[model samples]
Target: MKSLTLPAVLATALFALISPAIAQYADGQDATPEQAQAYQDAQGCILVLKAAGGDDNLQMAEQAMAKAKELAPINGDDTDEKFAKSMKDWEEILGLASVDESKQFLANCRETWSA
Candidate 1:
């Protein structure tokens, strides 16, 4: 997998600290930090898979992304800002990820997040 950029990693850390109270699963359970990170990774993986462009990968990536979001949806008033930041982070990840790395991310997402 590609290493996370410093800014993206920092933004994620900051968001976790600032919005701990607002972040929760669809079932109303508080999300652990690891769960939140997995969710973010799944989102990033989806972007990578989409850019790579294969029907099979896209289908699995979408399923993983959906499951990740269902388990840990971003909530509260700053939802738009949070999503914007996440998109930027995913873009950065996409830029650095090689085909093999991107495929690894997709695999990880399917294993960790897909239903």
Candidate 2:
């Protein structure tokens, strides 16, 4: 029998939570400026999470996310519709890779950002 994996499980849960806003983009609808910024910032956080390989990774990720929030400040509670939708969009774009792939991307992000 095939076993369920963590990423698969997470993806399934994400699909259930996210809105059809993902599909809206496929029809050539452009993201608003706020949406674009949120996606960009989330993508950066995803990289930081991947790069944080030491014991404090989760803390690092949380700090980075909080800082991003302070800087950009999206609306609504995380469980609320609007915020959840934005998270869904951000994850749809930035959450595709496996762990190894994310690590590779993290390395690249570090190089690009540090230069």
Candidate 3:
């Protein structure tokens, strides 16, 4: 039998909860600004987790990233601009964060994203 990782299991559960709303966006319907912002924030958290560089964190980051992308693809529209801004903002935040702050942020992300 295949073993599921914690991140994978959590992501599956989270997706089950949110997939209906995400599906409408994924199916070429317009995503609201709030949805776009949430996607960008999730991407930023995924990036931060990946940067943290532990095996478990990396796995979680990958799982979260996959779900975020699936839910809100940037299709050269307004979301593209929001995504760019989010990356820049998150990069700055990452640079400014101390190790402890990063850890706390990661912990919060794991809770928020279920990853």
Candidate 4:
């Protein structure tokens, strides 16, 4: 039989790694102009995380997510990002690849700010 424990352990660690941002999304509610700016900052982190790749990249993505969550608001404030939580959700769903992919993703995200 396969060793389930090893996989379980790895999964646990992975969850723990992402828990911070997950917690932020759950506990964090509403948003401020500052939070919105913070999300904008996250756009940068995402690029680095996307390009950095590997475990380090995951960590960076988590960091960027935290920042994005910070800026994420329940309602639209100064930024039209809509919901920071949603953006974080989107980032995860987007399945970020390498730096180039991240650049494209961030560019699209940045458009929201420009328009």
Candidate 5:
């Protein structure tokens, strides 16, 4: 297979890094730094899976689901617990974002955290 040129590799890396910060999910106005980071990560996975499409999309979705199932439930201060639960919930849906219910997952993120 042909290798990617240095510029191509750099561009891809930059895009991948920035895509996560492109508002894939909303961090509530009151979210703490930790919560905000987790929220963004979950959003990144969701957005990535959505953009993957086709069979690859399903594969990405499955990996997300498996990772989520392995995570322990939230168990800490109110702040930690809230974000933990929120992250777990949003991320779990990410594994299915390329399937028929993909939009449902994104919708859940918006509806999940209403002001």
Candidate 6:
């Protein structure tokens, strides 16, 4: 019960942050190529993480997240407006579906990619 609560809480918070970004896309606004690619990767990772109950699925999610992170631009101080916005969107996805092994995978991705 406690374990389930954590993921639920995290997912709720993630959704809170994600709604606005999603609305932009929903309004038929176009995302840049980089943003589109990153969104696709993160969306794939999140779906796999949410449904995954095995190591194989977890691995696939991790790989997808890694690719998403790679496509996102890193900004020290997050001063680059577009890059910062893109990362915020990507991080929201990480928050939404990451749990247990998926959380560990996100941590690893951050560590490896941090500037």
Task: Choose the strongest candidate by TM-score.
Answer: 1
TM-score of 1: 0.53
Listing every candidate in turn, what is its Cα RMSD in Å to the true structure after a full C-alpha superposition? 6.6, 9.7, 9.6, 13.9, 13.8, 10.7
Q: Give the TM-score of candidate 4.
A: 0.35
**Stretches of candidate 4 above 4 Å error?**
1-34, 74-115
On residues 10-115, what C-alpha lDDT tens digit does candidate 5 reach at each position?
2333343334333332433334434334434343344545565656555654554343333212212136465465455444444433554444443443333221
Model 6, residue 23: displacement in angstroms? 14
Model 6 poorest 10 in a row by lDDT? 1-10
The global Cα lDDT (0 to 1) of model 1 is 0.55
Assess every candidate by TM-score: 0.53, 0.39, 0.52, 0.35, 0.28, 0.33
Model 5 regions lying over 4 Å from their true place: 1-43, 72-115
Question: What C-alpha lDDT values do all the predictions have?
Answer: 0.55, 0.45, 0.57, 0.45, 0.39, 0.47
* lDDT (10s digit) by residue, model 1, range 1-115: 2223334433444354335533554458666545665566556666766765677768877875674456444432136576657666567655665666655655655454334
Find the 10 residues in a row with the least total lDDT in model 5: 1-10
lDDT of 2: 0.45
Q: On residues 6-110, what C-alpha lDDT tens digit does candidate 3 reach at each position?
A: 233334333433454456567777665446545544665787778878887778788767656664554222375754654565566566566766666677666
Residue 17 in model 4: shift from native, Å?
29
Best by lDDT: 3
Which runs in model 2 stand beyond 4 Å of their true positions?
Answer: 1-39, 42-54, 74-80, 98-101, 108-115
Q: Please, what are the lDDT tens digits per residue for candidate 4 over residues 4-110?
A: 11123223333433444444545664544344335444544564456546775666567666555554543232254545444455345345345555455445433
lDDT of 5 at 83: 44
